[model samples]
Target: MKEVPASGAFRQLEPGPIVLVTTSYRGKPNIMTMGFHMMIQHAPPLIGCVIGPWDHSYSALRATGECVIAIPTIDLAETVVDIGNCSGDTVDKFERFGLTQQPAGSVAAPLIKECLANIECRVVDVVEHHSLFILEAERLWIDNDHREWRTLHHRGDGVFAADGNVLDLCDRMVKWRHFPR
Candidate 1:
């Protein structure tokens, strides 16, 4: 894979294809599709996400320091794209989309009940970089029941991939083009 310089101008390095992250402050709920997020460490298990300060939820996330990372399936591609394209400041996305916001453990931010897997998060660090706000959230609560499901993965150019047929990797490693078995 070609690596892009991190310091270069913001260009779609690669469509991150992560599930949507939701947050709420004082009963006001907000949701946004995020791709540049992942597990950064394992000792205590940490997650890092990036959000533009210009976004409405940025201030709420910074102020409340809490959020819920909702894992969406490929079926929700349209809604996920919609959430990303629009602004939560002017719209009540939850109500508009008829999404159910349910209670969570670690943070006051409600999790999307419709999503299969939900992880409650508490922001532990905030780093200001240019116009973006980097959030490091500790995974507080995880509601995972690994039912037969397909997760949404961004394929760039406005496309998503859900869990497809299982490729049995029970052998530990699949045949690789570069690495010899």
Candidate 2:
């Protein structure tokens, strides 16, 4: 491990899978690709994610305090990257990508029909200094019929990794069994 720039530390510590966050404001719905997000709590199903002022979805989230986190599978790798490459301010991502939009139960933000799972969330807190939004899951929708289950992970730059073979260690999770599934 040779000396590398400290700025590149995030590449090694990237958290969780890349997801699409949707927000609707003034009857216009928008989707943004998010790679910086993590689970913060379990009881209330809280999630912390970075959606800075630079992002088009930021204003909508700030005003509405709601959004949907859609987890896409490996098959959408190219589409996911393409979504992030453009700005929602100029483009209607849902129509541009031909992605089906399904109405969410708890939030005005629509869910991507192609994704593996969609979590409707409401902002519970905002850490303005860090551009962090703490969201509480209001509802969850999963596609049990969708065959693709592998999710994508961003490794900084243009690199990404997809979920691979499962290492079933359920028997070894004695201490974590009490945690919710």
Candidate 3:
């Protein structure tokens, strides 16, 4: 086995798909690309994500305690990376990317019409030390008609993998039969 730096661990075990997080404070809305996030609970639908002060949207998220997590498909890969490359502090990402903003019902943050799914969330708790925000899903919106369903997975260092093929093993799961497929 080859020894690897601990700092490179994230590239080996990157969680879920790359997502776009939107926050609105005062009257201005902003969006940032997030690669560090995961589902923490199912009953209340809690999600844990890392949004530090370095991110321009962090202040808005902390002040308002609300944000929208938008899941973009493979087709929007370039736009997603471009959104992350620039700061919302200097650029109006929505306008710069020509992304359509749809009003969210539970949060002031706008949903990206181009994304595959959008989850409106409210911050339930914050771990200041780690800049971890625990969010509860308040609402969810999905584009049932969208043809592209593949999502992007960040592999660190600007590399990414797109979802491909299907592995249906639902029947093999004896313990998870009670849950929806």
Candidate 4:
């Protein structure tokens, strides 16, 4: 075994598809690219996402307490980077990136039309010091035709990896048959 630095471990160890977090305040909508996110629970679907206080979308997210986390496939890699490169403070990301905004079922934040999936969420809790927002997923929408879509994951800096290959471990793992459908 080899030793590695602990401080920057998350750079490469972080997992999950890069997502577009859309939040709306009043009648204005904003979208931001997010990579630091994870699912915290299964039942009722809880998610945890970190949005730094400095981010332009922070205020809107905090005030509204709702957002749409959209999962974009690798086909949107370039546009994802472009959205992340600019601040939503002075830019309308949807128009700037040529993205389509579709109304969400349970949230004011709009779903990104081109994404593979969109999860509508409402903030259930917040950890101010950490800028950690715990969300309850209220609704979900997915592109059935993109069932085989590959999603992009950020690998620190400007690098990213597209999901590839699949391993089935269901047989060796505990089944969720007891869980509600």
Candidate 5:
């Protein structure tokens, strides 16, 4: 389907696993939430995150060249917004949000204690396209312990609809305008 660029589209951003970003600056640690992330490959897994330069967490994620993205659940909606809304540079998001930290397997960034899953990533690439920052993360450690986990996929605006009700698809076709968003 052809994409129509709409401003302020209140898209129900699919609720994804809210990943906590832990970064260390000058021996100090910081953690942030990221929903705009994905895994590109399985073998020698490649991860991707869009880290905008203007964001508080952006510089940390880039400058440190290291960070941890811990996946949270729907129950963490409040914490997700708390970490995602506030700047990590000035505020201790972890402490302010009452999050506990755990040692990471491969990097300096710490993992959030209550997260459902954790991904330890090392920066491998950065891309700039039309005022957006895209960083490629090399997944070194991945832990998915939560038995019943749901993914958060962006649906637009601040709305993130949790992924539920599994579906299987075969061959398919539909008119763009008629297709469900």
Candidate 6:
């Protein structure tokens, strides 16, 4: 085995999926690519995401206290990268990318129709020092027709992976059937 540099090694620890976060504030809707989000809990569905203070959508999210987390399939990989490269502060990403906006049931943030799944989240708490926002999923919309919808997972730099393999360990593990969904 070979050794690698320790700089920015945190990215290797947990390279999570890249999701498009949509924020709508004062009649303006914006979309931003986010890779620093994770599921914090199952019951009442909690998600923890990191959004820098300087991000354009951060102000809207912090002010409105809501946003939509859209999971995009591999087909939109290029568009996702493009969206991430640019800033919503200067560009109208939704119009530029031709993404359809669908109104969410619970949150003010509009959902991206092109994505595989859209999760409506309301800010539950925020850790100011860490730029960590804890959100509770108020609504979840998934494209059930596409069972094989592959999504991109950012592996630092410009590299991304289409989640392809499925390894089930249900049989070997104890099933918690009583858990609330």
Instruction: Score residue 58 of candidate 3 by CA lDDT.
Output: 91
RMSD of 6: 1.8
lDDT by candidate, in order shown: 0.73, 0.93, 0.92, 0.90, 0.67, 0.89
The alpha-carbon deviation from the true structure for residue 86 of candidate 2, after best TM-score superposition, in angstroms, is 1.4
| Candidate order, lDDT descending | 2, 3, 4, 6, 1, 5
lDDT of 5 by residue, 27-135 (tens): 7788766666666665465776776676776777667878877777777767777777778768887789888888887788888777776767777767657323333
Cα-based TM-score, every candidate: 0.77, 0.95, 0.96, 0.94, 0.73, 0.92
* Of candidates 4 and 2, the better by lDDT: 2
The better-scoring model by lDDT among 2 and 5 is 2
Candidates 1 and 6 compared: the better one by TM-score is: 6
Query: Which digits, one per residue and each the tens of the lDDT, describe model 6 over residues 1-181?
Result: 6788887676775567799999998888999999998899988899999999988889989999999999999889899999988888899899999999999998878998889999999999999999999999988999888655888889877789888887886665567756653
Model 2: CA > 4 A from native: 1-3
Flag regions of model 5 displaced more than 4 Å. Answer: 1-16, 129-148, 167-181
lDDT of candidate 1 over 1-181, digit per residue (tens): 7877776523354344467778886778899888767566654556778888888878888889888888877667788888889888899999887888888866788878778778777777776773333344544444466443677767664676677787877476555443432
- Expressed as tens digits, the lDDT of each residue in 1-181 for candidate 4 is 6888888778865768999999998889999899999889998899999999999778988999999999999889899988888988889898989999999998999999899999999999999999999999999898998755999989877689899988876666566656654
**Residue 136 deviation, candidate 5, in Å?**
6.6
For lDDT, the strongest prediction is 2
Displacement of residue 180 (Cα, Å) in model 2 is 2.6
Which consecutive 10 residues in model 5 have the weakest lDDT in total? 7-16
User: Candidates sorted by TM-score, descending order?
Assistant: 3, 2, 4, 6, 1, 5
Root-mean-square deviation of each candidate, in angstroms? 5.7, 1.2, 1.1, 1.7, 6.7, 1.8
Cα lDDT of candidate 3 equals 0.92
Residue 25 error, candidate 4, Å: 1.3
